[model samples]
Target: MHVKDVMTTRVVRISPDNSVRQAARMMFDNNVSGVPVVDDQGQLVGIISEGDLIRRTELCSGTPSPADTGLAPDEIAAAYVKRCSWRVGDAMTPDPVSIDEDASVTRAARIMHERGIKRLPVLRNGELVGIISRWDLLQAVLSARQDDLPAGDDAIRRSVLARLGDNTGLEGLNVTATVSDGIVHLWGNVETAGCRRAARLLAENVRGVRGVVEHFPDPYPR
Candidate 1:
């Protein structure tokens, strides 16, 4: 599978100048843990997460230091709060590691692992196309399993489950597939509208998927 096959294209974005509080609100409202920081032209510049915002609060600072590191929580909080006052451009990881849409899902997974990151922005023709998270990789892997196994009509059902587990980390996606001559009928609730789209795309990408009967609900069950 390709990175584009599982990325969330309709991204939630915030301006660099947006306050940490505002960013947090956006994340909460959208039920997203992070938002891409973008410029006026919607160019992806960085990313901000709940951890970044929480780090700025005096009361919500880090844990108590170990004996080896003699640092007060307040001291760490003070520094973080100070940086939070600046625009995201000053604090966010500038020039984030990104992947091309055509890149394989395995490559995307490798990049995330190497960077110790959960997400990666997808680029196409030098422009932002989408973003893929570790969840996406998981879903892709699940989808690949169904194609690898050969079985009866019930085979597609297990295939869909595998797809759900692999392509997305969303565990509750209820999958029911009816395979007749390798044609798949898919039904399920995915984590997000993006995930629903990804599920269908992966089904199509799989070999012997004659057609997909999609009944995936948007804004999947939490």
Candidate 2:
């Protein structure tokens, strides 16, 4: 499914001019770990997380001793920006990673995994539309499973094939599918681990799929 289907539209954002204390309070009151930092025109410029706030000098005894950091003079100057920064723009990570709202949730998951980020801002035409977090993806998985499978095993099988075929990686893969009593059985050969995961997620995302059993044999040896 697309990010728009699962992303949270009621996003809380902070301005670049806002104070770190204000940003921290906003996150605490909203119970979020991070927030998008926007410009005066509401354009996304950066992100401020709990990690950023916790590193502030006010919370960490003003500044680290030169001996403690052992940093070069230039490095020390750069570190000072982080230590002394009180405004969101100064402390926030600039040019943060973002995703299009119409992109697949799998793509979102992959980006978050590669970046080691907790959340992603969903944008459309260069404007913030919503936000998706690890929690939101988890919720999507749980909710997708709870949905009732479509009536008839044939219908289920067709749906499974359709979903897999929709993915370009699985488009030419030799995949077979069968469904009985809402449980899907997938037997296939894929070129890569990503394709294997693609097959599984495609099946799992289909409504009325109670369970999926994959028997995919990878062609490449580890």
Candidate 3:
């Protein structure tokens, strides 16, 4: 399955103007590592991860002052007590690595591997629609193990359609599906590139789908 197939739709978000403390609090309360940053009009602007926050702390104190050049690293870190106030624009990784909803899961995995990112932003028409993580892909693998796995492409097609029906989110997805070997092929239309990806993730979660190949119509408005 692809990143879109397994990504959660109920995404947590933060505004670019939101304080770092506020973003950190949201992550803490939601038990998430980061959030997508948006604008007043709800556009995907950037992403802030736990790693970014940690980097803030490191940079805030890790810088060696002229007077502290002789100090040990631990002592320097200890002496650098106050966190420098920063904006989302300052702390965020702008234009993060992302996937279109209509790309293959293999491609998403490959991009993540190449970029060394743990999660990928699912984009639709150049907007942040959702995020997918390593955990989501792992879940796709586990979800495919239940029941008697389909033995061939036709059976896999039937199994995938059944899953789309079962997944109401995917049921509303305007896409067609085909199968070859164990891979599911997706075509048709969606509201956004994000929805396309969501459709694929749904297919991945089905018990018989080994992988997904998405080639959907561009849902972006001209």
Strongest candidate by lDDT: 2
- 2 or 3, greater by lDDT: 2
**Model 2 lDDT on a 0 to 1 scale:** 0.85
Rank all candidate structures by their TM-score, best first, as comma-separated numbers. Answer: 2, 3, 1
For model 1, the superposed segments whose C-alpha errors exceed 4 Å read 58-82, 145-222
TM-score of each: 0.55, 0.68, 0.55
Write one digit per residue (lDDT tens) for candidate 2, span 1-222. 899999999999999999999999999999999999988777899999988888788888766645447788787776778678788888898899999999999899989999999999999887888999999999988887444555568988887876665544887677989898888898876758788778878878777778888777757558
Winner on lDDT between 1 and 3 is: 3
Per-prediction tally of clashes:
11, 1, 6
User: In model 3, what lDDT does residue 80 have?
Assistant: 53
Query: How many clashing residue pairs, candidate 1?
Result: 11
lDDT tens digits, residues 30-107, model 3? Answer: 999978888887677888888778755545565535666788877666445323445666677677777887777767
Give residue 141's lDDT in candidate 3 (0 to 100): 71
Candidate 1's residue-wise lDDT over 38-65, tens digit each? 8887777888876566555344453432
Comparing candidate 2 with candidate 3, which one achieves the higher TM-score?
2
